[model samples]
Target: MKILSLPALLFSLVSVSEAKKFQRCEVTTTMRKAGLDLYYGYSLENWICMAYYGSKFNSGAVSGSNRHGSQNYGIFQISSRWWCSDGKGKTANGCRIPCSKLMDDDLQDDILCAKRIVRDRKRRMNA
Candidate 1:
């Protein structure tokens, strides 16, 4: 078998590393857009971990046994019933996620909502 050139192998490794780094950079940017920078006060890794556990960073991170069985809606599990009343379920209006209604994918809204929650928690702790 013919041996591969070192430069080619090095280039491939560098490309993969760059791709991963870009993904992480995107996560950090999204976190900042979500107001995490002002509220969480943690590293991008922490933000990513928390959001992943919460909704896997999907805009429509709904969870439940069945599609219609008491399903929790949105990235933060806001609940479809409540979200509907808030005009968040209407696609034509201003709801970020038309189909999934997850809100996590909408980085700006997700970050703002998360920031609010983080701030509230901090207040509680200080109190």
Candidate 2:
């Protein structure tokens, strides 16, 4: 029988918990196909830049508390205060999704939520 050391087991577990980060070009291509390239009149470079600054393309990224005691989630760092529910505070939940969903490997839900946020912002600005 083979025995694994405790450190090795912990390392494996930690690695499993870490999310995969997208390359800049890969993110650009995916967002382009998702129609996010110019969804909010923002270019592909803009989206890539936001993704890089927000979470460094890490789908599992979660931010610490903001001034409103809300956190940001996922690659775009969508706020828990307005976009999705984090279950520990009040949220408008404009995306109508659990914040954890945004952290998944699949980005469909994240993209949808981002679009909703952008639309809402545009509406507010136009109003």
Candidate 2 lDDT, 3-119, residue by residue in tens:
568767777788333356888888888899999877768777877888898899999999999989999999989889888999989998888999998887777888888778777
TM-score of each: 0.45, 0.79
Error of 2 at 118 (Å): 1.0
Each model's total of backbone clashes: 4, 0
Q: What C-alpha lDDT do the candidate models reach, one value each?
A: 0.46, 0.82
RMSD of model 2, in Å? 5.1
lDDT of 1 by residue, 39-102 (tens): 5466656667665665655555556633443344444444444222234332221233332434
After superposition, the stretches of candidate 1 with alpha carbons farther than 4 Å from their true spots are: 1-24, 33-35, 38-40, 65-72, 75-104, 122-127
Cα RMSD of all models vs. native, in order, equals 10.9, 5.1
| Candidate number with greatest TM-score | 2
